[model samples]
Target: MALKPHRSPRRVNLISPADRIRPDAASVLLKMVEEPPPDLSFIMIAEDLDAILPTLRSRCVLLHARKPDPEAAASWLEAKGLKDFDEQLAEAGGNPLAVIRGHKIVPDEARALFLGLLKTGKRLDITKVAPGVGTGWKLDACADFFSRWGTDLIRVKSGLQPSYFVGETPELQSIAPGADLQRLFHWLDETESLKRASSVPLNNKLALEKILESYRSVFRS
Candidate 1:
């Protein structure tokens, strides 16, 4: 597809978070990047430029973007009807696009409940999970947070400091003893998969619940 011809207008290929491209996939694209078709243009976006492959980095011209002002970004999201994004905005490091990516799958109250459940470790009762815990709410954001939380659990269990979910050291410590190391890795993989497919969840609530089941299993082992 990279070598395909465009009749009239140029075809633009936009890849967000390009750093996540698998090594094999990046290898496949390396040739096309070196000699791209005249009709095609690829714009790769990444939050961390250093994570990009050296081969790709050497060939492409880098452009750094300024971080958006937190207050202004928050105002814009609120204006766009993404209310109570203070937590999301802060977590996103002032990236408005990241904050908006969730599309408001759930409200703040449900967010609180979901995190509360995670803090329960082995005691997380799926049966008592709130209705809005999944639904159509902030899916990308939810998956991101869920992924980070599981990672933190792994770190705590491995006797390391929390990398992403800071300020949760106490809760992570409480949950660490019950974590099965191998299961935590598996759970993290599933969470990352959920985040990738979060854009089009056929059954939004079910998707989140299924991942939550994996999370609950991490403690059981």
Candidate 2:
């Protein structure tokens, strides 16, 4: 058996995004937050409150940042000399900073690829689509894509409009009938866990394979 290395605890200021901190780290951080050294302080930021660990969230004073209005965001983008400002604003979900920083919140290609795979139904093959679910940030983006796709499917099944893929309602409708609701919702839960765990180093290939396999199971007809 290998011996476990000892770690020396040190005092330092922590400036981290609440969402990015993993569960294990959060537990350790919680103790610090509950009682920190006089010289140390913590500043945590997070866009999604639900993504933050509940224990950590409860300890901090919450500050809500309202998203900008779409029209205002578009105007800001235009003032910055960005063409197709409306499209960019929509793609960024009206987050002006995201548009300004050139972050593509909506992965169009990944969404299309996932929808196509969903359309395959029982014939879906995890190996063939594994490349699309690339490693690291790309894999995280794929999980985001699948989460939205699954939400849209659920919405369509409930006789509601597909929020993420409005134009692809017909395709959503096609797959909704065959989708295993329980499995799909379970997969959504798993993807949320995956997204929360994304900040840490992970086995990307194995993770993607498992996700794709779950996707395959969701469409068992």
Candidate 3:
């Protein structure tokens, strides 16, 4: 496609060096970059600089893109007045992009699901699981929290302290009665496997229900 004509006096031509340019074509393109047409400029967009020819890099100006701050992001979210504030932030998994998108997912619902899982421990009942308890809503939350919870349960079984969860710390501490780490590990592995497999089946809801039930069995065992 021909480059869009910009209103600016300096012309900007966007090109990809990756394109298979004939030697003559490359010479011509290089000439354009070296000595741009009158009131014309060249802009090359590259996915990575390392891939570009040294000749091209020598003539181009490098610009660095900066990401937004998480603290500032959290503050912005707070100012927007989202209910279940902490849960929204936690669901973000420390990514500012996720925090910006937290409003799309129901924070209260996701939090309740996570908390419910923690509260039940080994005795958690899958049949009575609350809504939105299934689906791989937040892999980080499940993997990180549940994995740690399992470790804590193992620690508790050994007469040691099972530290707390970020929001569910108190609840975890309260329910810290002896845990079976080995069983917990097995359950986590099973749940993770099922969760991953949920993608294969079209009936995602049924798959999730089976996953929850499977988890319940692991806990019961």
* Candidate with best TM-score: 2
In model 2, where do residues sit more than 4 Å from their true spots?
1-16, 37-41, 85-91, 105-115, 119-123, 131-138, 196-201
Tell me, by lDDT, which candidate is best: 1
lDDT of 1 by residue, 132-160 (tens): 55444666667777877777788788899
Task: Candidate 3: list runs displaced more than 4 Å.
Answer: 1-86, 103-114, 130-165, 202-206, 217-221
TM-score on alpha carbons, each prediction: 0.59, 0.72, 0.44
Tens digits of per-residue lDDT for model 3, 124-210? 765555355555455433444454555555555566654433455556555554344565668667655543443343454454455
Per-residue lDDT of model 2, residues 131-189, tens digit only: 76533346556667668777888989889977565666788897788888898899898
Taking every candidate in turn, the Cα RMSD to the unseen true structure, in Å, is: 6.7, 7.0, 11.2
Better structure of 2 and 3 per TM-score: 2
Output the lDDT of residue 201, model 3: 39
What count of clashes does model 3 give? 1
- What are the lDDT figures for the candidates, one per model? 0.74, 0.71, 0.54
Rank candidates, lDDT, best first.
1, 2, 3
Clashing pairs in 3: 11-41
